[model samples]
Target: MDLKPYANYLRAGSAMIAGLAIGLLATVLSLNAGYGFNSLRAGPWTSWPHIGGADIDPYARAVISRSGEAPLGRDQGLAFIARTDSDGAPLDGACDYRIVDPLPAARYWTMTLASPDGRLVANPTERYGYSSVDILRKEGGAFDIDIAREARPGNWLSPGQAQRFVVMLRLYDTPLDIDSTPDPNSFPKIVKLGCA
Candidate 1:
C-alpha cells in the first residue's frame, strides 16, 4: 500500500553508498600519488623539497605518516629516491646495475638500497648503504656502487632476495637550490648492466 515511498527511500540509500565509496577511493589515490605536488625530478630520481619544511602539505604529511618515514627537516637536508634506471627502466633485483656519481653539492650524502616498502634488503654482507666518507672513490673523487645479487669488487650493494628495490640518496646540509630544477646529469645515474 506504501510501495512508492519505500522505493524512493531505497534509491536514496543506494546513492549515498555509491557516493561514500567514490570519495574514499579518491582520497586513497590522491594520498598515494607520488608524495603530493611540487616534486623536483632529476632523471630517475624524485624529491619533494617541501615535505621536510614547515609548510608541508596535508597530502605529504599523510603519506609520510602512513609510510612511517620521518623526513629530514628543510634546514637539515633533502632526500631523493630513484625507482628506475637512467633509461627509465624499473630497477629489478634480477638485473645488475651501476650507480655512478655526479652527485650534487652537499656537505655529506648517503646511498642506501631498500625494498619498495622502505625496508633494507637482506644481504649476506649485512651492509645496507654507504656514506660519502665511507664509499670507495676513484682517483678523481668519482665513485660507483654496484647493485647485484653476486659479489662485486669495490663498492657493492646487494638487493639480496628482494625482487625489486629503490635507491635512496640523502644529502645532509646540501647547498643545492630547491627553487630551481636541478641538473639531471648532476645526479647519479643508475645504469642497468645485465639481467639474470
Candidate 2:
C-alpha cells in the first residue's frame, strides 16, 4: 500500500498547527509579562480615579486646586499646580505640556518631568529639568515647553517610553505681588500643545 502521500499531508498539517499554537502562546505571554511588569513597577503609587467628593488625599487635594504651591515648612514660596485631564488626573504620555510662569516679572522658574515611578526622566543630554534661565526665549521673553516622545526644536523634554508622567513646576522666589491663597488663578496654566 502506498501511504507516502498520506504521511506527507499529515506532517504538513501538524507543522501548520504547531506553528499557529506557538505564535498564539508567544502573544499571550508577551501581554502577560507587560501587565505584570507594569503592576510591579506601579506598586503603591498607582493612583485610582477619585470617586465622589470624599476620601481625598491631601496631595490630591493640592493637585486639584491647580495651585502648584506646596508648603515648604514655615516659609511661603512660589509654587503652581500643573493642569490635568477632565477626570482630575495627569495627562498620559501622548499629551504635550507647556508650563508658563504666572508671575510676569518672575526671575526663575523650572519644570521637571518625572516618570510614574517618581524618578527624573533620563535624557541623552543628562538634563532632566527645564528652567526659564536655561531655556532659549524670544526677545519679548516668551518660551514654550514641549513634552513628547520625540524631541522638539526648543525646550523639549522627552517623557521616555512610559505611558504615564508627571510635571512638577517650581516658581523659585516669585515676586511679592502674587497672593498667598491657593487658587487656580495663582498658578500657571499648562496648555496642551498637541499629541506626539
Candidate 3:
C-alpha cells in the first residue's frame, strides 16, 4: 500500500544526486584544463594578472589555490607565463631556445624555467633562472638567455630530463600596468631552434 508515493520520492532523490555529481565533475574539469584558467593573454604569454588581489576571479583563485603558487597583487607586482615558442610551439627540453627580452617596465624581474607542475626543472648547470640584476646585457638593458637540455655559454637555463617546460617571468615591485595589453615588440620573444 502507498508504494507509488515512496517510489516517486526515491526517483526525485536519485535525480538530484546524479545532477549534483555531474555538475561537480564538470566544474573540476573546467578549472583544471590546460592554462584555461581565468587569465589575460598578451601575444604568446598568459597571466592571471590580478592574482593575489581582490580583483581575482573564482577560477583564478581556484587555480592559485590548487597549484599552491603565491602571486603578488597589483600593487606588489605581476607575472607573465609562456609555455610556447614564438611560433606557438610548446617549449621542449629537446629543443634549444633563445629568449630575447628587452628592458621591461618593471622595477625588477626574473626569468625562470619550471616544469608543467610549477617545480624548477633540474639540470647539471643548476641554473634555473636569471634576475634582472644578474643578467648580462648588451649595449642596452636588453638581454638574451639560452634555454636547452644542454649547457650554453651565458644566461642559460637547462631543463635536464624534463621533456616539456614553461618559462615564467615575474616582475616584483613594478609600477607598470601589467593587466593591460602592450605593444608586442615590448615583450620578450622565445625562439625555438632545432630539437634533438
Candidate 4:
C-alpha cells in the first residue's frame, strides 16, 4: 500500500552506506601506499638511482645534495644513517660518541646528530651540527668530534638521550660519483663512552 515511500528510504540508505564504504577503502589504500613507500625508501637495502653517473641514494640522501635538481633542488643535503650498538640495535642516547675521520677534499663536511624521529636532539643548547670548520685537528690530519649530552671542551655534538640517534654527513662540493657511492665506513660511528 505504501511501498513507494519504503523503497525510496531503502535506496537512500543503501547509497549512503556505499559512499561510506568507498571512502573508508580509499583512506586505507592511501595509508598503505604511504607506509610502503616510506619503508622501501628508508630500508637499508635501498640504493639511490643513477643521476648523471652519480650513485646516490636518492631517497635517503641529504636534501642539500639535490641542489639545482628538479622539485627538491632548494633542499639541504643532510642525509643521515643510523648508528647501531654492538648488539646491532640503535645506540643509547645518553652515551658519548667520538666521531672521527680523515679530512676530505670537499670545501666543508659536517656531522649532525638527530633523534630517532628525525628531529634534532633536545639539548640545553640548540646546536646540531659539527663541521670540519669548527672541529679541532688531530694527528695524521684526522678530526675527532664528540657527541654527548653535556658540553665538552672541544668540538661537541648533543645526543640528548640513550635511545636512537642518526648521524648526518654532509660533503660540500663533493664529486658526483662520490655522492653516488657513499662509503659506509666514512660515516660516523656511535661508540659508547658513558652515561650522561
Candidate 5:
C-alpha cells in the first residue's frame, strides 16, 4: 500500500494547526496591549473590573502576571486607561487632546500618557503626568489639560513621537468598589483636537 495519501493528510493537518497557533498568539498580544473581556467603561476610559483582586478571570490574571507590575491593593486605589479620544478615535501623537470636566470622587488622582505598551514616553518636556496637587482646577472641581508635543500653559502632557498612545488615570482612596461602579459620566472626558 502506498503512503502518499496518509502523508498528504498529515501535512494539511499540520498547516491548520500552525495557523491556529499563530492566530492565538496574535490575539493574546492584542489583549496584552488593551484590557481583557472583563473591561469596564467610564466615558473614554477602560478599566479592569477586578483590578487588584484575586478573583480575576484567567485571561485577566494572565495579563496582569505577565506585565510584572504590581497593581494597588483593592483598598489602595483603582486605575483606568484610555486608548481613544471622546470621538472613539485612537489617541495619536500627531493630534492634540483636551482632558476636561468633572472627575470621579477621590482624595487624589493622577493622569498619565503612555505608549500602547504602557511604557512612559520620552520627550523633551520631561512631563509624564498631572497630579491633583499640581493641576490647575476651575470652579466646581473642573479642570482642563492640554496634551500635545507643543508647549501649552496650565496642565499639559506630551505623547512623545509615538503615533498610537494611551492615557492612564489613577484614583486614590476612592469610595467606589467592585460592586458599586458609579456612573461613567462622572469621569473626565478626553476630546481629540485637530491634528498637525
Candidate 6:
C-alpha cells in the first residue's frame, strides 16, 4: 500500500548506478586515449615531455602506472610516437611507407614499429626496430627506412601480419628545446608509398 517509499529507493539506486557507470567510462577513456597534458606535436610525431618529469600531471602518472611503461627521465631524453603519417593518415600495415629522416640532435636515437598498444610487431626477420648506431645511412648522413610486408632494397622494416601499427622514436641525450616548439622539418616524415 505504501509504494511511494519503494519508488524513492528505486530512483536513488538508479541514479547511483548511472553516476558510477559514467564515471568509470570517463576514466577508462582518458587513460586509453593518451598521456595527459602538454603534448608536443611535430608533424605526425607527438611526445609528452611532462610525463617523464617529476612534475608530471596526475592523469599522466595514472596512465604510466596502468600501462607499466617506464618513461624516460627528463634528463635522459624524450620519446615520441607517430600513429599517423606526415599527411595525417593512420598507419596501416596494408600500406607501404618510407620514413625520411633529418632527425633532431641527439647522442643516440631509435625507431621501432609496434602495435598501437606498444607491443613489438613480429615479423620473419625478427627485427622490431633500428637504432641510430645501426641504421644504414646514405651519403652525407641522410637516411630512409622502408616499411612494408615485402622486402625493400635498403633500410627495410617489415610490418609482418599486423594490420595497424605505430612508430616509436626515442631520442637519448638529445639537445632539443622542450620549452619551445620543435621544428617539424627536423623530424622524420612517414610517407605512405602505396597499399596492397
Best by TM-score: 6
lDDT of each: 0.93, 0.53, 0.80, 0.54, 0.82, 0.95
lDDT of 4 by residue, 72-99 (tens): 1212223334456423545677677676
Instruction: Write the residue-wise lDDT of candidate 2 on 79-113 in tens digits.
Output: 33333632355667777766554433456767777
**What residue pairs are clashing in model 3?**
none
TM-score of 6: 0.96
Native-to-model Cα distance after best TM-score fit, residue 53 in candidate 4, in Å: 12
TM-score of each: 0.96, 0.51, 0.86, 0.54, 0.85, 0.96
* lDDT by residue for model 6 (92-182), tens: 9999999999999999999999999999999999988999999989989899999999988989999999999999999999999888999
List the pairs of residues colliding in candidate 1. none
Q: Give the Å shift of residue 56 in candidate 3.
A: 2.0
Query: What tens-digit string does per-residue lDDT give for candidate 3 at 68-123?
Result: 87777777777888989988999988999999876358778888999987899888
lDDT of 5 by residue, 1-196 (tens): 9999899999999999999999999867865655466666777787775757766676666777778777776688889888888888888999999998688888999999888778998888888998999888877767899999898888888888888889999989988755655687888888878899
**Of 4 and 5, which scores higher on TM-score?**
5
CA shift at 150, candidate 4, in angstroms? Answer: 3.1
Give me the overall lDDT of model 1: 0.93
What is the lDDT, from 0 to 100, of the residue 12 in candidate 6?
Answer: 97
Model 1 C-alpha RMSD vs. true structure (Å) is 1.1
* Predicted model with the maximum lDDT: 6
Per-prediction tally of clashes: 0, 5, 0, 16, 0, 0
Model 5: what TM-score? Answer: 0.85
lDDT of 1 by residue, 1-196 (tens): 7699899889999999999999999999987686898899999999999998888888889999899888998899999999999999999999999999999999999999999878998999999999999998899899999999999999999999889999999999999888999999999999999999
Q: Tell me the lDDT of model 6 at 131.
A: 96
Model 5, residue pairs in steric clash: none
Off by over 4 Å in 6: none
